[model samples]
Target: MTMRAALCIWILAAVICVGRGHAIVKHQAEQDTVVDSRANTASLVNAANKEFVFRLYRKLAAHADSQGKNIFYSPFSVSTALAALSVGARGETHQQLFSGLGYNNTLLTQENVNQAFQMLLDRANETTRGFINSGTAVFVDNKFKPQPEFLETLRQSYLADGFNVDFTKTTDSENTINEYVKEKTNGKIDKLVSNLDPSTVMYLISYIYFKGQWASPFDPVLTKEDMFNVDENTKIPVQMMNMEEELHSYYDQGINTTVLQLPFNNSYSMLLLLPDDMAVLENDISRGHVTKWLKWMRPRRYDVYVPKFSIKTSYSLNDVLTGMGMTDMFGDRADLSGIAEGQKLAVSEVVHQATLDVDEAGATAAAATGVGIMLMSYRHIPVLKFNRPFMVIITERNTENILFMGKILNPKME
Candidate 1:
């Protein structure tokens, strides 16, 4: 690889190796704060800006699906990275966001970004600690925070890498942030933060954009009782979306692995590829043959039978990430000196939680629970179908940040 490319790879490797030790934000425990008002107010209205973010979500979803992992993805961090960029983020921001996630490298300013990192230091650390205690099986996991010194490294790297430097606007941090979320999720995600307390040290914002249709929409009326193979002795009431059709890349590989794809109304859709006999599907997923299979397939309709499911997954990402290569930033060797002079600073952690309710109303019926409830006219129905082994991608109209991508081999078991 060329020097620049090599440098990029090294930066990413360092992040992967060091990311696990960071912490989670602490304010999330404030339940009485009220979700409706905080997430649905007028102080933050950046509609056109939000649409732009959605484009990124779309791109990310497509790329993840292409990579072959049964993806249960999120681009919230990516969106935050972009937001940081909008306000002139530097190297640390890029490292924390890109390196931490295994996405392509991005460059930004060092001093400015480090300052921002310093601003969020305490909360970031807490987030990491939470992950260490919670774990990934919970579904929603927090992304780690970078140490201040690490943020400096990120800034220096970006400058060294020839990244375009742009001035940031902090005039209305809240408005800009919400606007970005709106655009990223096509307005599906709005008011990620409400009533930003200037005194509040750490503020986290995510944009979840999804647009997928069922391989076959369930007849709202014909929904009947069926045995959902959740496990050997577990079967429950499920609205089965049924359709018999031929698919482009259907796989029935050995080891009881089965893969299938269901296209959404747009370029995206839901994918459900399952392992026939594996006790746990994640093992099959971690082995890594998904990207190759997805890339070499065609897009065709198939007859599918899927059950409607509502899943809530919350996780603290410390261990899984530590296991994934981000080790340095966690312990002693961590270089977070930049956050505070002579002060021992390390990224505490990240905690991410997501709840998905898929039904005949549409693929991303999530909007009903969010901003869409108010803007009744702009609401798009959600379509939920779980039939063959398939993949699901929620991408924005432009940009590389994919909102969410993952395969539901068997929603029954998860």
Candidate 2:
């Protein structure tokens, strides 16, 4: 029998699809000047920086899955890791070139950290609003949130850690990509990603665009008369989309778990894993079993059955990330001196916004639009089983970039 698979690649992989493989090109003079100046300061600079950024993301994302928490992927981790790598650069070092981006160790404190976060948020909010040319209903914030003392410790340790640091900002390039991502994500996320507050050393920018359809599109008519499993002995009334047929790739058996892969247009796919043992294995399945299962696969079309559903989730990753393994970036031991002349700096927040839609046909509904319209939808057999905890992974076919990583500990809450 075919097993379920859900692999979480880094967010940048989606860049491959930004403009039909055009790479969202930038003018040479513009990028070259920024590179020439900050080259020595940032160790993980250049196109190759994406590799290191994703490698770090894979490890951290796996850890989050293992912990059984609802974790959202972002470029925040990549930017932080890059900043860490730039911790101790010299004038000749590329690290030295980015001297303008770091925090003043002297000014590193809780109040200052808050100011930096708010600054970035304000800029992103303004830039995104401008791109939409209208106000959006999207809510946004940062991922790193730690106590003031915890943040201070992260800063002290970072300075004491002695890592090479390089800091610089190229608004033109960052904003350009930010605009594309905002357009693709439908203004769910903002552009203008910057924080030159002296404490910040390096920056990594990531873009994610997801347009998926529910496996089962709620029949405005047949969506009635369905009972959803709420708990061990509880059930609730919900309009569930239901359809059954021979499915191409699907899980046949797994205690109470249900696993299904819903295909989108361009070889892109969504892997949904429902655990039979909800005792807390969703995270493990997300990190461990998914990759292993992908290795053994067969391709064929079959009849499918799924539920139609729609959900839009917004999350703040500050606590979830620190709880995993990024505490150093926000404490006295933060060590981002390489980005600038300042000593005090720590990560303050990470923000993520996501939307999912599923219906009968496939993912075609989401991507249904003319080119450059920043629109996409899906058409797939709806797989409705709200009986247990579950996870979802959205991936691009060519580069295998994971646009979004999520888990629903309590579907009832959603």
Candidate 3:
């Protein structure tokens, strides 16, 4: 493996890893904050940014269906990493990256994007919420010196650091990168790179780790084996956790879907969407749909039951990204001169991995694992049971920034 060839892998993998997320941003500016106003450029920019995230999510979700597997990815991480990469990107490269990142505020320039993402990194770093540790790092061949502009932009925009490494020693290099990911994710992502080619010159990586508890705790004793209806004809036994909490929820009778908010330790919450039929799960996952769910919701109490499940998924986004109009960035036509001052570079691969563990404090696992929370019955209080497929989201209450999300066709499948 040539050091040159290895650098290609490093840049793509690291940047791609960054396009992922687990670190949740704190509460947004303010509730009274207009969704979009020219004077409120930050607010306007943020809302506009989510449009792209939701669009990307839909595409990735479809990919999950193609593989017949449960999946999750951190779009925030990916965006942050890409923002760092865009430091030296010019022309079409910058255009594609910005478009993919949902940066459409006409009033905001590319510099504004750097500032916004930097602000988010700072917010997560300072937040007291459940562990949200995020950072970016760039490792380069000692023989090559990165330009001041690239390094400074990366440091400011993504809170990134730089290091010199021996890419020729693929074993040590691979182990080092994997170790870094392991530590950053609290060991959730242990082996991101199994083998490193010797031709690498520089590699950059972005990572985030999150662990939060529910505001309401579930009763371990109440957890029991229940039938999870994957479909009309498929049923599997799963460890179903329960709690009786006086939580605010919205039950849409028209769609036979329920929206319940499960608060986390800090300012984060899990907005669960339980539908009556599995067929409707994909149709209702858009940002607009979630916004509507929140608007239509009023406080209600129910005997809530949810499955205790853990899912880990990985994806190769090279094709999807190319399909998303990032062709030049990955091909010879690429112009990544800003990074090295005068050198030409192109990305070769983009791999992303993620894990989701929904085990709260008190709820017991089917194989003896524990989870978390609420209310019930007179003549008969409403019972909200997730004894089937459901969708869940972990987000910051303040910003409504979604950190993680997934659809459970069958908890047992994971």
Give Cα-based local distance difference scores for all models: 0.37, 0.38, 0.66
Model 1 lDDT on a 0 to 1 scale = 0.37
Instruction: Output the number of the TM-score-best candidate.
Output: 3
Score candidate 2 by lDDT: 0.38
Ranking by lDDT: 3, 2, 1
Task: Count clashing residue pairs per candidate.
Answer: 95, 93, 36
| Residue range 304-362, candidate 2, lDDT tens digits | 33444445444444544454344555444454444333334444544444444445444
**RMSD of each candidate relative to the true structure:** 17.2, 14.8, 5.5
lDDT tens readout by residue for model 3, 102-209: 676366676777766766666666675435667688888877777888888887667776777888888887888878777766666678876576766778776766
Q: Candidate order by TM-score, highest to lowest?
A: 3, 2, 1
Q: Is candidate 1 or candidate 3 better by lDDT?
A: 3
Question: How well does candidate 1 score on lDDT at residue 73?
Answer: 39
